[model samples]
Target: MKTITKTSLVAAAGMAAALVAGGAVAQTAGIATVQPDAAILSAKAFDAANQQIATTYKTQLDQAASQQTALNTQLRTLLDTNKDGQVSQAELQAAQAPNSAIGNQIRAAQQKAEPQIESLQRPATLAQAYAIEQISQKYDAALRAVVNAKKISIVLTPNAIQYAPPATDVTRDVIAEIDRSTPTVTITPPANWQPQQDTVQLLQQYRQIVAANAQRQAQAAPGAGAAAAPATTGKAPQGR
Candidate 1:
């Protein structure tokens, strides 16, 4: 995905909405920007798979969440020597001295929990990868069709530019094309099927976007612990 960073840009509509909001740029010649990953995320097939996976893997998902919380707590207790609520990489490194007892305990705990976490997450992970792969198979053709139809001579990612007019962004157009081409994707992967390495990375970015959206929604909900501020600090994970 990174290899296509400039040539093949990506963004979901939710995130792209913010990026595409700026002064209008009037161009006589064809020029545009598209977010490929976001287009895929916004695809109908991807949304359906997300919902299906959440329901089908409810047990594993719940268990994984609980396990992650416990692991974070353990890591904090072991490495947060200064008693900060958060643990830092420097603290972790310092705790893992050549003959440190804390290092041995941390290593042992992580080793034991690592496989358990992986096992619990495997189903949903593979399911997501499969869905992404199914949709992404049509990306090239969809992009090409959009470029030809829109007469876009030069395309760039929103990330590559400081600002651009909303009209200059063809992300939504591309997403529509993707949805039309691959309306629905499957969560069920074939037996012994393995995801391509790129799919796995894309899956991770997808999860990050989902998590960020969830957090944003939670903060915006009434009676929440804290008021949700505008999300300007965190940028969506770039395609890898």
Candidate 2:
């Protein structure tokens, strides 16, 4: 029951290989900079969670990597076959047969490993999900406790508010709480514990802002209209 499904094994291995092969980094203006990613990834809780996952899941991961490596070796051998001090046309043609053969080996390996890895990885991913949820919940609880204990009217995640007094950020306590309640042995996110806010509030806010802007624009229209007429002196306003 705990075996890695072949799909999981192959996918996990492929992703790891891709990462190791000089992975492409997306170019986002500020986000691509080393400092932001380093700061986020270096956080103790994040490192702890990922390391814990790796520790619990490393066996299958290693096996997957090993399988992938073997496939790569097989492929390379096929491509480089008959390469003995001279590159010949016959040798080149002969290599195609081996290429086909190597492809078969890799495919077979993927088929076998995919099921095993998936079965194994499902449990780990479930654990990850649970842990993230627990951490977030604990963080919320701690924020509430701190807010109530300190008699503060509000406390928020740092980026949530456009501007708050320095005291409003309860990040330290949140992190402490999150770390303390880290999921012991799970990777799956809780089905009910969605961390992202829903669309209702966002839509409501957008509508309110739009209405206010429309009102302001309407109020200014009379003044603007009286002064500008789109250079009508040259062409009688094109449609009038």
Candidate 3:
């Protein structure tokens, strides 16, 4: 997975703005700046959600880990039938044979673990994206309310500006409004739910671009060529 950076979040915010506003530019007459880093804000939200989710699933995760450990022990014992502390390759092969009862038990244990493993493999990006989406749904209206109350026609992110007076920044106000409106959000989404199509596509493109750039840099790096033969002097009669 590509690392999610502040740069990418800023880019995502810009894209989000374009989509939300239909590419309309805010009027310059009464513009107010908001220095909210979408990435940072999203990260904060994700952290909160992650903590809640972790707490909620702690028992289940623990149980799954314990079950896995027990299964491993059982399989090892089954293979080491001679009680010599180590199983030979032949012993392992025999234990894994199709008709072996131990083999069937091991397979059943693995099958039971599949769902737990899949649950644990939920993508962090997906969770973060969902958290951001929920935050927007809950707080964007409050932000707009602040804008309206302040008679600000335009709200620009920090990325769009060179500099702004501290007084003109409403990021704190926006955050305060969000906190007042929704202190906590749902972290666990419905089973099998997927992120929005556009979000998925955007992330996929971002990952591909990052991967290509990395590959290009690797190829252009010094000493990227195959190892060369050790240099030898014409006089090679000296013994080591």
Candidate 4:
């Protein structure tokens, strides 16, 4: 929910058209670029895994989403001092004043909602981790194979350079390798299974990408007004 809201699978790795065209960068002799998260999430296996997860954890996901919506409404009501039905930066900051009564109320509300939401979300989170773990296990070998095949000596993230031709982007190739090597991943974890911190973090990023996509879709919907409010964060609408 943190940085996840701003992440998008297509935008983060490469745009969809570019990916479908096998990525846009032209390859340099000894260098290639990859965006690991993008490649992993874009794989066909990940899509299949997500559908399974949605079904497997439908109850928990529905409950958590409902709770979050209610919480967002409550937070907006508490912070929208002008009664304009919108919580803006100025409104949130006013509510966040040191020892302010509304601040105390808002904090109390969030404190209560946070645990319940997290609890309901746990199942899906774990399921995501389980799927990611399965796919990620094959990532290193897949990457190395691509690197060797291309005779690339150095691999870098998309952000590592100022510019590169689209052909240099190997994200699509890596995704292909992952899909072939790990055609499907299990969403079911052992009863005692717990994800490592890295998996947890990666899943978090994946979720964020999902959220960002949802927001974009919502904004682009037919009836979406120019002034349509952004999705609520269950906290101040802006930094205090």
Candidate 5:
């Protein structure tokens, strides 16, 4: 039997084709994104923007730390939680009620502050966002560019390939396209979309409590530190 070849096509004004060169049991077609991980674009710019956001909310974060201490202290006072060194479920519920209220307040505050932070960080964020959008668009363009330039019908990720005639992967061409477009492009989260200072403050406070507990635990049980590694993770844990 003759092996049939296939091709890949992207909708972003690009075209490509695949050539078959080996005998095979079957052929398959599927769709996959040939794009850079959004999380990897212009790391320095994104990191800077993230650091600024933290700096902007530093004061609030400190306030949150204080409040968390007071709340947990309040919990300690209640039921000793029976002095067992852990709050009773009932006592825990009681203890958390006020914290929950505080959380609501913090959320409200964050809602208030998000806009301001958004304003201050707009230029940097826009630059990053634009860069990513370009990545998505250009990766496809590059694929098409290479395919059209080479006159192939399709291209695939290196992994998708099996035994076949060697052809230019075109991934390099696609990457170049992404670099050209993504770096120059820009995106802004919204001039009005600031994260709330109040919420940030609350988050900071909660974080402080968390840190204090972590430190205490580290002191109490040093081994836990290796596994419970806590970091202010995620300037873009959600995405790049």
Candidate 6:
């Protein structure tokens, strides 16, 4: 069977989290600093925006999975002539011969479906990155106001600081300002939009590395029935 695993797609999605968070951190000189996570979590509109993105992509993933499952079933049915419940290496080799009718059909189906399956990975990552950028840009004014009110000269993300008193944290104040000004954000993005070029390139590299590793592991796995030698007869059979 020709298997197109989605390990790379999942790796790309995991990289998106870093990209989103990277945009939220900004360096400034200040007596007080606020954690972006605390502020973002507290904002109801930000939460809603994330939920909307997740729902949309989850539906897309479900549809893609269903389509791929149907295609795999068709390919298996054509190749498993003996109906032994497993497609052995020998059986697969026979089906893939140049003149094999079933083999040609399987190859054709895979050619049509592979691109459709691979296309889902990038957009899924882009949607979340776009949503994060939009929310951060829309709330910048609120965040600035909190900084100014506290007479803070610098604003740093939580990770940048080694230790600080609770009194120096302005996360709650920023959240309150965001809630007051923008109660809810729009979920839909403009047409034909894409994420920043740098982020896209980084994600692509990460996917490639993960995919290479998965391929190596698959190649090293033992073939079916390699674990035990054929049972030996007690003695050679008598001549007929």
- Candidate 5 segments exceeding 4 Å error: 1-33, 36-99, 133-140, 149-151, 156-170, 177-240
Candidate 6 weakest ten by summed lDDT: 228-237
Better-scoring candidate (TM-score), 3 or 4 = 4
lDDT of 2 by residue, 113-201 (tens): 55544554544444444443444444446545545544565433334546434333344433344445542324445564433332222
Taking the tens digit of each residue's C-alpha lDDT, what string does model 6 give over 1-240? 122223333333333223222232233346666655445434666455545655666656555556666776777766776776556666677776889887877778777875665455335445544544455654578878887776678776667989755556666677678778877767565786655554344333433444456446655776632121111111111111
Candidate 6 C-alpha error for residue 44, in Å: 2.3
Alpha carbon lDDT of each predicted model: 0.64, 0.38, 0.51, 0.67, 0.36, 0.54
Q: Report the lDDT of model 4 for residue 32.
A: 90
Candidate order by TM-score, highest to lowest?
Answer: 4, 1, 6, 3, 2, 5
| Model 1 TM-score on a 0 to 1 scale | 0.68
lDDT by residue (tens digit), candidate 4, 1-240: 222111232234322222233446445888898888767667777677667766777777777777877776787777776787556777667676899888888878878887777777676666667777777788898899889888988999878989877888887778878888888888888997877666766666665555566668866887653342224332111111
Report the Cα lDDT for candidate 3: 0.51
The lDDT of model 4 is 0.67
TM-score of each: 0.68, 0.37, 0.42, 0.77, 0.34, 0.45
Point out the worst 10-residue segment of candidate 3 by lDDT: 229-238
For residue 198, model 6's alpha carbon misses the true position, in angstroms, by 8.4
User: Model 4 segments beyond 4 Å from truth?
Assistant: 1-26, 217-240
* Candidate 1 deviant stretches above 4 angstroms: 1-28, 80-99, 157-166, 210-240
